[model samples]
Each structure stands twice: as C-alpha cells, then as structure tokens.
Target: MYTLLIADDERAIREGISRSVSWSDIGIGRVLLAANGKEAYDIIMKERPDIVLTDIIMPVYTGIELVEKVKDTMPQVQFIILSGYNDFAYAQKAIQNEVKQYLLKPCDAESIRKSVQKAVSRIRDIEKKEQFIASMKENVEKLFPQAKEQFFRDLVHGSPNTQNIEAYKELFNVHDGPYRMLLFRIDDNDYVKLLTLKSLVERNFGEENVTFCIIINTAVVLLTTLTGFHELSGLVEKTQKQCYANFNIEATVAVSSEGCISNAAQMYKEIRDIIRFEFYLGEGRIITKDDISVFRNDYSLDTGIQTEELSAAIRTGNIDSVKSITNCVFNAYRMKGYDINRIRACGIELFIIVLKHCEDCEINAWIKNITRINECNTASEIKQFILDFAVKLAERTYQSVISSQNRVIEKVIRYVHENLDDENLSLQHIASDILYLNVDYLGKLFKKETGMRFSQYLLKVRMEKAKELIKASSGDIKVYEIANATGFSNNPSYFTQVFKKYTGCVPKEFRETGKQEEKDSGWLPL
Candidate 1:
C-alpha cells in the first residue's frame, strides 16, 4: 500500500477529504495531513509519501512553492493541486509545473479516488523493479565475495544501452584530477550495506567530465583528464557535509597513493591501495593517499615475544592464550580492509608455527575438520577462518575440562585394540596406560570416542573372533565351547545372541551358509 498526504490551509477541506474518501479501499493505509505547504514538505521529506493532494493557495506557502522546493528532490511524487478560485492563471501554472491535475476545491470523492488509484499503481511498478534488482543481487552474493564485488563494479560502469540515457556524476569535493575514483560505503550492513553506500556516492559525486565504474559494492573508480589536488580535496570535503546533513550517512573517501592515467580499471587499483589505510584509520571513515605511508620494515604473524608465547600456546593447545593472540592478529588485519582469504592465510601461518614446536598429533584433528579447506584465495577468507578457528580451538582446549578427556580418548583407543579378547576388561584396565586420570572419567572418554560402552567393544571383538573360528572349521562345533575360549565369561546363551547381532544370523546358520569354508576369510566389514 502507498502512503497519502493531504495538505491544505482550510480545516474544512482537510476534514472533508479525510471523511469523504475510503483511502483504505484505494491501497493507501497511512494518511498524513499538513495545514500549510511548509508542513507538507516536511512530511514529504520525512515520510516520502507516494501521493500529495494540496490546496493551491495556503497561509505559509502555496502549492506552486511546495512543488518548486520538493519536486527536484522527489520527482516521482504525484501531485494534485486544489484551489477555491478556479482562475485560468492558477490552472495554467499548475499545468506548466506538470501537476497531475488542478481540482476545484471541494471536488467529488470519485475524482480523488481515481487519482489515488493511479498513484498506487505507479508505486507498485517501482516496488516490483526494486524487488527484482534486489533478488538478482542477492543470488549473486552467495557465489563468492570476488564475484559479488565484480558484479557491483560492472553494474555501474557498463553502458546503459543505445535507447537509454545515463545520469551525470555529481561531484562534491572532487577536483580536476587526471584520474578519479569513488569510495562507496553502505552503513550498518552485515550484507550489502555496501550496495546502498555505492548508490549514494553515484548520486552525490558523479559528473559529466568524469567517467566512473563501481569497483565493489563499497567503492567506485572514476578517471578524468582534469588535474588539481586542491580542487580534489574541496570536492570530497563538501560531499562529506551534504551526506550527513541530507542523508544521515557517513562514508570514507580514500585517495589513491598516486593518481593513475585515465584508465578506469588501473585507476581503481591505484585507489585501492589507499584502502589499506582503513585499518590504521578505521572503517566508516575516509583515508586518502596522504593518509597511507610506507616503511622498510617487514612483519609476519609473529613479533618476537608475542610470536613465541602464541606459538607455544598453539603447540600445547593452550587455546585460551592462543585465542587472545589470534584476536590481536585478526583485528589488526581486518581493520586494514583485508578480506577472509588473508585472514585464513594468517591462520595457516600460525598453524605452521604451532606445528614447528609441536607434533601434528598434538594438534586436534577436529580443528583440521573445521579449517577443512585452509586454501587461502583472498585475505578476507583467510582472516575469517583464523578468527573462527582461534575462538573455537580456545574453547575446545582451555575450557579446562576437555584436556584430560583428550588423553583418555587416545589411551582407550590404544588399549582397546591391544587387548581385544579381554571381555573382562573395565575402565580400571585403563588406569596404568594413561596416568593421573580417574576411572569414571576414563569411562566417559571411552564412550565419547568409540561410541560404545567400554565393555561393549570387548564383547564385539570376542564375537568377531568366534565368527572366524566357526567359519574356519570343517568339523562340527557348539557355540558355548567357542564362547568360553574367546572370553565370553560363563554365559553361553548370551554369546549366541551377541554373535547373531554382529553377523546378522544365528551362529549355526551363519556357519552353514559359509559352506565355501575357505572363502570366509577375514572378519572385518566388506
């Protein structure tokens, strides 16, 4: 439903319009009324109503003045002027302004309803176009970040077509530089807030003398033959003020380390270098070429003592400490505008450091499952992986309780395989193999890893051995005799039950079906 505004100086006209029209029936739900042109303009700016029905002459400002003030800003708004004096001059002025219609005051409800319906239809069409663009962009985002950035760039830079005209760039602080680039930012977006930001810059900073293409949702590139740095600063500084005053937005502008020739793509990369300053300067703000500087120093993830301490922690899975260090590293780079690929590469580098001091076995295999594919394609992806693994590994390791369980997991797996025939074995059998861990605690670990009771694995193993004995023999044998030898204790009836579960048949039937006696070889799964 579209929003409708009724503005007039006369109380009777306002009340009559409100009471006479079935606005809800015409797809307008919210109705705002203003007593003067100034008040109506305030509503139009704030609420951005689809239709405005206003009296031609009002106390503070006339409908003509209202149209003059707001039409350029909101050109799509449909306006119908109302007047008590049906003078030819008033109608001609309204027609010149392209007002939808000039109605004699106290017009019938049917006349107003027709205008309202037409306005709603126009709004619906605009909404459909917006929805289609949003959906198409949404699908493209899921493919990859690089693809998403390229799509945004192509959208703004590509030609509109032979049948269409393109809007000119509106430069604010930009000057006559040899090359120009735009930095677009969508605020508060976990998703494509970037797109909104890009759109805003195109509106505020575009110009005919300059040609620009969006490089990503968050930035654009413009190139021109004009030259002058002072003029450039003037343009950016002014654009900054208008953005906040007009749109309630704050976006950062980054000047390239050096301006490029009038090549759009090359100029884009040159400007992109300034993005590195986003870390030191921060996001949601601008950093220009002057803001960035170079040094002869080189630094890796490790910085002397910090590296030493962090590497040691990662080696032993002293995860809480590792988490603290990982945070420092990721935050430093992420603030620099590095994407996930850079982040994950840092993660891999840290892992390598950890690997230097510790065995692969010391590192949790579960972490390998999580980093799953640590192939770093971009800075952002890598950074994200590091951030994710750093936190989770910390939780798994230094949550303080799991460390003992880790050892117990390893020890029990070794013990179970070594003494498979000992169905009499219990958690107590594990105490000597892994020192300093309790029997009850050991039972928990055994179950967590092997997914069976400690006693259950032993029983399964004995049954497995019994199956082989039955199949290997050419001579007849009873199940009880085989059960006692394979450590079934003294329960003959239970042994046959356990054997049936493992082999999916009664022992006698299983032995008979395997009449190609020599063919029944190993007891493992096929």
Candidate 2:
C-alpha cells in the first residue's frame, strides 16, 4: 500500500483526515498529518510519501507554495488540492500544479477516496513502466557491454548515449572494473533537483576519461560506479565535496570491488550492506571504502541448478544422455547448495558457447535470446533453462544427423543415374564416385545408407532406364540396338530376359504399359 501525507491549517480537518474512512482502503497503509504547509514540507523532506493532500491556504507556507516546492523537488508525489474559496484564481493555481482533483472545503470522504484511488492507479502504472525499462536495460547491458560502455561514455561527457535502448532506459553502464555501491538519502527528487544535479555534474567535471550514470530525483538509489575500487577512494572525496557544496544533504557511498558488473544482481547486496550500516555514517557524510570495508559480505546467494553441461551436450547432439546428466547435476547442486555465482557463470558459458556455435556453423538465430540469458544473475535457474532448451536442441541434432547419414544411399543412387551409360559403372565405380570404401565395404555401406543391396539396386536402375528408353523411342528399334544402347552390348534377347526378371514383363511389354500410363497422365508426345 502507498503512504499518504495530509496537510491542512485547520487542526480539525487534519485530525479528521487521519481517522476518517480508513486511508488504507484507498491503497494508503501509512498516513501522516501536518497542521500547516511548513510542517507538511518538513514531513515530506523526511518521509517522502507517495501522495500529499493540502489546502490552498495554510500558515507559514501556502499549500500552493508547498505544492510548487514538492513538484520542483519530488515530481512523483501525487497531490489533491483543497480550497474553501470558489475563486477562479485558486482553481488556476490548482491546475498549474497538475493536481489530480480539487476538493472543496469539507468535501465528503467518498470524493477524497476516489481521487486518491485514481492517483494510486496512475502511480502504480508509472512504477511498472519504470520497472520494465529497468529490466530491459539490465538485459541489454549484460548482452551488449560495448553498448553499455558507450552509454557511460556519453553520460560522463554530458552527451546522450544516442538515445537508443540503453539510453532511453535511463540506465548507467559500468566498464570492466571493480566497483563499489552506495545508497544515500535525499530531500526530494523533483524535476528541478534532478535536472540541476544533472546539469551541475555535466558542467563541473565533464571528464572524458571517467564514465558515470547520474539519475537524480530518486530518493532510494543513486547508482554510480568507479573505474576501480581505488578510484572509489577518490570518488568518496569528490562526492563529499560536491554534496557539501551543491545539495548540502548527507549522502552515503557504498563502494563495490572490481569484478564483472554482469553479476550486478550480486552487487545489490553490497549496496544493501551500506544501507544497513547507514547509521554508522551519523549525519550526511561521505563514507569511504576504508569505513565500509569491514562490513562487506563474502556470502553468495543461491543460484539454481546449473545445466551448462547439458547445453553443451545438446549442442553436440547428445540428446537423452545429456538430459540425464542435467538431472543428476541438478540433484547434486540442490542437495549441496553450491555457490550461485559460479553456477550462473556456467549458465552464461552455455549461452556463449551456443552463440559461438551458431556463428561458427553460420546458422540463423534470434539474437535477443543471448541478451536475455546474459542479463540473468541467478545461475542455477539459467542452467536449468539451458538444460531444458538443450533437450529439444539435442533431439533436433539427432534427427538431422540421422537424415544426413541416411542420404548416402540417395547419393549412390544419384551417382548411378549420372554414370549409368558407362559399362564400368559397377558397384566399385559407384562407391568410388560417392567416396565410399572398398567394393566389398561399399556394398555394406550402400545397404546401410539405403535399404537395398548393391546388385538389386543396380538391376532396378537398369530396368527403369530400359523402360524409359523404349517408351521414348518412336521407331521400332531392333532388340540388339536397345541392349547396346542401355549398358548391354550385342545381345538384345539377353537384355530382354534381365528386364523381364526385374519387372515380371519383357522390355516391349514394359514399354507398352509405360506409354499407356504416360498417355493417361496427359503426356503430350512428340
């Protein structure tokens, strides 16, 4: 549920709002009340509630001033403007602030609830879009670190990263370095503060050498990185000087060590370590690597079962066997609770291997898949996905290999078709042309690659040719002529008998049937 802040000069209204209609029902679980705009502003600076309700007229600071202040610093805070006066000026001010609803003085509970509900829905939707973009950026970074490098290059140099996917995601990419993390507190992240910080950073230290991502107006996370952990020491000094001179707010910097940012999900723990130790910083101050070094966690999260071996097995077309290996590996890891980072690394290797194989084999693939897998921080889950994916891959490979092996027979058949007129085109000739072994071995391979013996196949070949030749020739050719024309010489009667044995009919009869079949099949004869 979203948190809410109620600000009004009238104590009765403030107290009444705190008790009335259960703000929790309207998606507000936590509600705070302030008697005037000044008190409301202070509360906002501290709590940073999602929604604020204020009257236009309040003590010390008008609700209009409060709204403007909050809008300038905390643009995300939804507001409902309340006014007793029905003047056009007050309504104009409300409109300027983008107030969701303007409630009259003593507005009923339903009116307030409805307005807040709508604001909740809008904020939630905005949050979801933001999350989606964040996820996209994360995936793109892991898959395309070069793109990430360019993003940081542009960001540090005060240029847009070409306004592409990573740029539009508003994500900062880190280079190959050991980075530290820090979570800091801010007054508010209104558009003014966000743009101001961005502008100041761009103007002050526009260093071509260093890369950074500065997303202001965010109270929770300020993700930044140093080229090296040692650079983090310098970063602390630089961040301190800037925070003191510019925003004057207390901020904490969590420094992560140098490693692959592809494992950034693990680094979140490092940042949270800083958050948990935030009280150690006392007031707003820069906490260097030395200060936070003692608290760093060497603990690794659980990565699901790894299946890279299975993926490799699949790529090589070792199907059912590799799948069994995957299951056994999963059981072992799940039982032992292996280090997740290591498992995740293996899963990444599988993806890389698959990508490399696809490239080497010159196969077409959907490129985005590699990006998605690379972005995943959880190793075991990736491994299982790879294994599952490999199962199908292995099956396909097996079928393909079978098909290729099976084509040898077809090749032998084709060789015969091309060289049938050569009397020397026997089993030895056919096997040699198709690159088979010795004649004896070629005969065995021929039967294996096809489903017929060499001698039988040759008979089938010659008989079919004889029938076609007889049907094609219009003149009544002599029997001996037909025999000599079709790989037999000087003995037409012998050729006819061989043809009769194969087709259960003499060559002439076979030709007569073929001619009739062709005529029935709509052949336009010459």
Candidate 3:
C-alpha cells in the first residue's frame, strides 16, 4: 500500500484526479489533495507520501521546484508530473528532477491510474533494494567481530605482513603502534570462569586496546600504544589482584617484550615460551622478558647420577639417604630452571624407580602420587610430593626387607631341624639346595637376623638334638645310634667329642648322669 498526493493550482484538477482515479486499484492506500506545489511539498514532508502527482505551474512553488526540494530529502518518493501545456521545457524540467511519469493536461482517468501505478512499481523496487542493503549491513555487523578476531590470530601466528599492515589495521580497527602479547595461564579449566576472567581483564585494560582469544588459555594481543606501554605494569598488577579477589583463581600472566604489529608472531612466541617458566617461578606471577632472560639459556636438566643415587637409597631402605638424593635432584632442576615437561618426566622416572623396588606395599598411593606430581604446577609442589613419596617408599622397603629376612632365616632354621639326621645339613646346602640364595649374603643376613653365624646355629641345633635323643632313650640305646640320629653319621667318637664340648660330658656319661639324677630323686626310672 502506498500514499499518493495530488497537487494543482486548480481546485477542480486536484479534486478531480483524487476522485476519478480508483486509488486502491493503483495500490494507493490514501489520496491526499494539495491545491498548490507548496501545499504538496508540505504534505510530502509531513505525511512522507510514497508517490506525488503535481502540476508544472502552481501559484506558490512550481512542481519542478517541489520535486527538487523533495527529491533531496526523500529520493524514495516517486514523482509524477502533471502539465497543462505541451511544452518541452516542462517535460525537460520533470526529467531533470527525476520525475518518472509525465502526464499532460486533459489526461483520462485510466492514464492517471497507469501513471500512479508506475510510480508505485518504482517505489516497490527502490524499497526492495534498500531492504537488501540493510540486511547485508546487518549480517556484516554481526560477523565483524569474529572476522576481526581471526585476523588478529593470524597476525599473531602467521608470518609478518608489513606490506598491507596499515590497510589491515584500518580494516580491523587496530591502532597502529608497538604491540605485545600477554598470555594468561589459568589454573582452573572452567571455561565460564575463564571468560569471566577475560572480561575482567578487558575491563581493566580498555576493550579497544586489546584483542583476546582463548587458545588453551586466554591470549591477549595488546596494542601497547593505545594502552600506554608505560602503564601496562600497573594495569596488569591490578588485573592480577582482581583475578584473585573476584575469581579466586591463580592466573599467571606471561608478557612479551615490546614489538611492532608486524612481528606479532615473535611476540606471541616469546610470551608462550615465557609462560612455561611458571613451573619454576610458581603460579600467579607476572612473568616478563626481563624476568626470564637470565634463566632463558639455562634450560638443560641435570640428569647425572641423581636418579641412580636415589634408586640406590630406596633399595637400601634408608629414609635419610632417599630424602637427601631427592633434594639433590630437585635442587638441580630448580637451579637450572629446566622445562616443566622435562622436570615432570624426571619425576615420573623416579616414581618408576621406586615402584621397581617396592614389594608387598600399597601401590595405589604411588599411582595416585604420579597424578599429583603431574598436576603440580610449581617446582616446590612436585619436589615435596617426590620427597614424601621417596621417604614412604624407603620405609615400606625397610619393613619389607626386615620381614623378608626374618622369613628366610625361619626357613633356614626349619630346614636344618628337618634334615639334622643327614649329617650333611649345612648352611651351604640350605642356601643352594633349599633356599637358593648366595652363600655369603645368606650368611651375613643370618647373623644380622639371629645374632649367630649359620654354621654356629647349625652346630647348636645338632648338639641339642643329640642330648634330647640320648636322655629320652632307654638305657639300652647305643651311643652311635644317638650320634647318627643327631646328624653325626657313622662317627660316634667325633659326635661324642662335639657333644662333650657342648654339654661338658660325653654322650654315655650324660645319659648315665640323667638316670642317676632320676634315681636320686625317685626310687626307679620309668
């Protein structure tokens, strides 16, 4: 639907056109009548009618002049010229004012309708084009930020593009000057909290001065000139405090050295590399180029004898030795400021070494400690876990070692008692044939466990068995039988010598003394 305005100096002409034309058929919703061009111009301004039909000659303003005034203000308003004279000048003036429809006077009702319809058609076309342009502009506005973010990311990671940098800056609305990259490493992985932190940082530093993207964590491409490079330290510190107080997060900021927009890739690389030092510097810190320069070249891990030393300590079940070696390893890493991954790997290596030496202990604690070690963000935390783990492992190993040595000594003693009649029962036979252990190691271990050498323990057991056999036997029991029964095969005299030395009497005399003692206490022996 469209609004149509009819204007003429003659009241009849204006009223006749409004009445004769079936305005609705011509897509005219309302027909406004103006007696002169001045009145029509006023109506056009006020009503903003879609189409205007006016005569060339009017009392106040000419139709041509009205067209000229309205066209500048509302180019979308289509104009139709009505002239009483067949004059080329009037038609020429209509054409000059961009009036598409020119109708001479005495035109019929059908002709006026056709001309108004043509104006309506032209108006519809103009509206469609305008609508398309508005829609396109709306979509572009929505996508503009995303495109700008991608451009910033490309500029940060890709090769330097100094050639068209100015045009790019204009396109992306980036201020031209020195730039720096700030990477925030958030301890928490909650994305919503991360975004909140980003918003907080952007608020502290104006949004236009920084472009942010979340890659692993938040990365900020700061326009140093816009933010004032000298003021960055104070702003970063303020943001850090806010992050702690508001978000309760430990966000460590790694800042690159001052650089141009062209070398943003270098700046990003520098900041990323600087962030890795947080493992040594501890978290929730503002690390800058100057802060890390001294240790930048000192990244090699000291993988010398520390691992071997720690392993040996754990094996020996020495808690103090284990702790000392653990301290040495961690101190070396802290001094060199090794890469965090390398340090983690070293920690894992020590964990494996501990696991290797462990037997019959709670393994889950060590496995959980591996995760704890990996999750530790700072050197001190990892060192503490390793130290505690090593110490506990040493204690467990010590208990296991003691329990195992007791069990082996018990087996050796049981074997000697079980095989005493063999007369070949010896520590060497027990170690090699029964227990399958090194003779020297078993000997020293036996003495340490029982306060007696294996051989001495064996002799004591044999002599005790001999005395028991002789005393428990009847008086008819032979000495040789008693000797053979007590592991002295076919050598009663030698057994007697050993038995006499053990009990201060020969075997026969010992038996006779026992009988005599029984006779003295009672009337007869059973």
Candidate 4:
C-alpha cells in the first residue's frame, strides 16, 4: 500500500482533497495532510509518503523549495505542484526539480485520483525490479560455494579456466601474493565442524588472504601474502589447538613452500603429496615439504619374497608372524615412498596370494572381497586392510586344517587320552560343561565319525590303557594300582571283571603272560 500527503495554506482545499480522493481505489491506504510547505516537509520526512501534493507558494518554505530539499535525498518520492498563478518561472523551477505533475488550483477530485493511480503504477514497477534483484542475489549466494570449489579444484589440477591468472586474481579478490597452500586433512564426520575449522583458519589469518575449499576429505586453504613461514606456523598452531579443544576433532595440516598464485597448482600438489604422510606420521600435526622429503629413502622390498613369506605365515596359522611380516611390508612401502596406487597393488597381491593358499570356501569368499582394498585412501587404511586379511586368513586356515582332521572327534579323543586317569572324564561332561555342545548331538556325531558309541569307545580306550600299564609294569604293579591308573580309582573288583572280560584273563594274567584270547578285543560287552 502507498501513502499520499496533501499540503495547502487553505485548510478547506487540503481537507477536500484528502477526504474526496478514493484512496483505496488508487492503492493509497493512508492519506496525510499538511497546512503548509514546512509541515508538509516534516510529514514527508517522518512518514516517507510515496506522493506529495503541495501549493507552489506557501509560508516557511515554497513548494519549489520543498521539492528541491527532498528531490536528491528521496528521488523515489513523486511530487505534484499546485499553484494559483499561471506563471512560466514557477513551472520552469518545478521542471528543474524533476516534478512531472503540475495541477492547477481548484482541480476536480477525479483529476487528483487519476494522478495518484499513475503514481501507484510507478511504485509497483519499482518494487517489482527490487524483488527481482533480491532473488538474483539469493541465487548467487546459493551457487557461490560450488563455483568456488570448482575453481580451487581447477587450480590444484592445473586446469584453471583462464590462462590469464590476473583475471582469476581479480575475480576471487586474491591479492598480491607469495602464496602458501595448506591442506587440512580433517578427521571429522560432522559437516559443521569442517566449517568451524575453516572459520578458525580465516580468523587466524585475515579473511581476505584466505580462500578455502573442500575437495573430497581435505580442506584446501590458500593463504596469500604471508609475512613469514614462522608466523604462518604460529597461526596454524593456534588453529589446531583451538579446533581440538573446542570441537574434539583433530586436523593434520600440510604446509607448502612460498609461491605465487600462478604457481598455485605446484604448491597445492606439494601439500597434497605430503598430506598422505599423516597415515604414517600420525594426525594433529603439521607436515611441511621438508618433513616429507626425509621419508623418501633407498629402502626396497622384494614383493615376491614378501608375498611368499606372508602366505606361509597364514598357512602355518601364526597370526603374530603374519602381523610382523605385514608391518614390515608397509614400513618398506613408506620408506620407499610408494604412491597410493603401488601400495594398493601390493595389498591386492598379498590378499590374492593368501586366498590361493586357503582351501576353505568361507576364507576364499572373504579374501575375494576387494572392496575394502579399493576403499583405502591412505597408507594407514591400506596397511590395516592387508593386516586384517592376514589375520583372518591365518585363523581360517588353521581352522580349515583342524576341521579336515575332524576337529570335534580329535578334541574328544585328545581329552580322553590325556584324562584317562580321571574317574570324572566322560563324553557327557565334556560336551555339556567343557565344549558347550548338546550331549545327544555330540554322541551321535562322535559315533558317526568313530564307528562306535561313546560308551563303547570309552571302555575300549580304558582297557587298552590298562593293558599298556600292566605290560609296562612287568607284573610288579598291583591290580588296584592298574585299575586306578585307568579311571577306576576305588572299584578294583569291577576293573578285574572288565579286564578278564576284555582280555580273557585278569590284569595279573595279562601282566604275566602278555597274551590274551583276543576275541574281537573282547570289548563289546558294554
């Protein structure tokens, strides 16, 4: 809605115009009245009405004077001059002040309304242009970040859109520079913290000198016109300390040497290469070109020999040996300054070698999963990937060998062999309390594999052990001693009965004669 102001020395004329104008039809919601030019100027200044109608000659200030005062300050405000005299000078002054509407005194109500309708139309047009400009600005703000990231990416990749670096310099407001690039490898998943880290850097260095972009997981900061390396380092130190203390996140920054904006690609590459050293050097510290240059060495690894040794360790099921060999391989890669691709290739080769040695279908399935290897972007992740594969393969390989030899049956047999002297040793005890398996299922499986029920196997094993003890004693060991040695500590009479039933003679006869009728080992009575 628009507002209008009417000023006339004659009160009746002012009232008549204000009351008679159908202001709502003209889109004027509020109509104000002023008796003279001074009052009109005061009301205009306070209310900022869209249109002002004033008599040409008045007290305190003339209509021409009021228009002159407001024309420059509020050019949007439209003015209409009313006069009693048909004078050329007044009209000329009004024209000079850019007042387009001039209404003679005693003008009809319809004429006034028509003028106001035109003013409202002009006001609507201005509002429409302003709204359009505001929308454009909002869209520009939304797209600014994407454009900025792409530009920085181009600079880093040496594919800047324009060879005229000066154009970019002007466009991004990058000042004269002996610029240095810092790549921040932030260990954070929180999106807000990335922005906070950027803000912290900008605060440490002035905002104008810093251009920041996030490329993948790293944040690229371009610092222009730094005072010195030490000062930059101090600012970086502050930023790191504040970031951890405030956000509980660590950021490792890689700093590049001094260079110009034109050399930004090289500077960026220098930091980009060094930033990967964080996996070896650890996080939350700054890595400079000088620091990374020391890591390159003449150390070399024999990939084929290392692969063989690693596979052998997995086959032997020695996890410690596997881990030691794996660590040595990664350390060699680091010392030799292998790139990420070479490291990943080494990992894949090691994985494939181990998988080839594993006969277990499950291990084969696990070793064939190359997604984890491809997902590794750093030396640490790659090392961990291979180490995890090594450990799993070793465990699975060991389990496979045991399973092929009938692990459950072997475990039961070993237990029986070791504890034949214990009266409490039984398959039910072993299954229910020791190995946590159901007794019935264990019995069925054991008999299926060993071709004898658990009780029959137990009796045969005890009888065999008793005969060995009797023979080894050369008839000097007593009957009770023989029984106690084979899980019958108190019942020597029952031991004698079973001994005679199995060997067709008593323990004493077996010890002295070393011979028996050997009727199916006489072992199936139980």
How does candidate 3 fare on TM-score?
0.56
Which 10 successive residues of model 2 have the least lDDT summed? 517-526
Candidate 2 segments whose C-alpha is farther than 4 A from its true place: 146-526
TM-score of each: 0.29, 0.33, 0.56, 0.51
Ten residues in a row with the worst lDDT in model 4? 293-302
lDDT of 4 by residue, 1-526 (tens): 8889988899999898988877997799999999888899899989999999889999999999999999888999989888887899999999998888888877899998887788788889989999999999999888877877777777777884847667766866766577788877676545677778877777778866566545444363655467377987888889889998987778799988888777778887788767766755779988897786654432112465776788789988888899988888888888988888777766665665666554444554674476688788998897887788679878887777658548888889998989898888898899988788899988988988899998888889999888778767755788888788898998999999887777778776666564544532565654
lDDT of 2 by residue, 14-132 (tens): 78877876777778889998998899999999999998888889989998899888898899999888889888888898788887778887788788888888889989999999999
Worst-scoring 10-residue span by lDDT in model 1:
162-171
Error of 4 at 306 (Å): 24
- Report how far residue 183 has shifted in candidate 3, in Å: 1.0
Q: Residue 416's C-alpha lDDT in candidate 4? A: 91
Model 3: which residue pairs collide? none
Of 2 and 4, the candidate ahead on lDDT is 4
Model 1 TM: 0.29
By lDDT, who's the top model here? 4
A best-first ranking of the candidates according to their lDDT comes to 4, 3, 2, 1
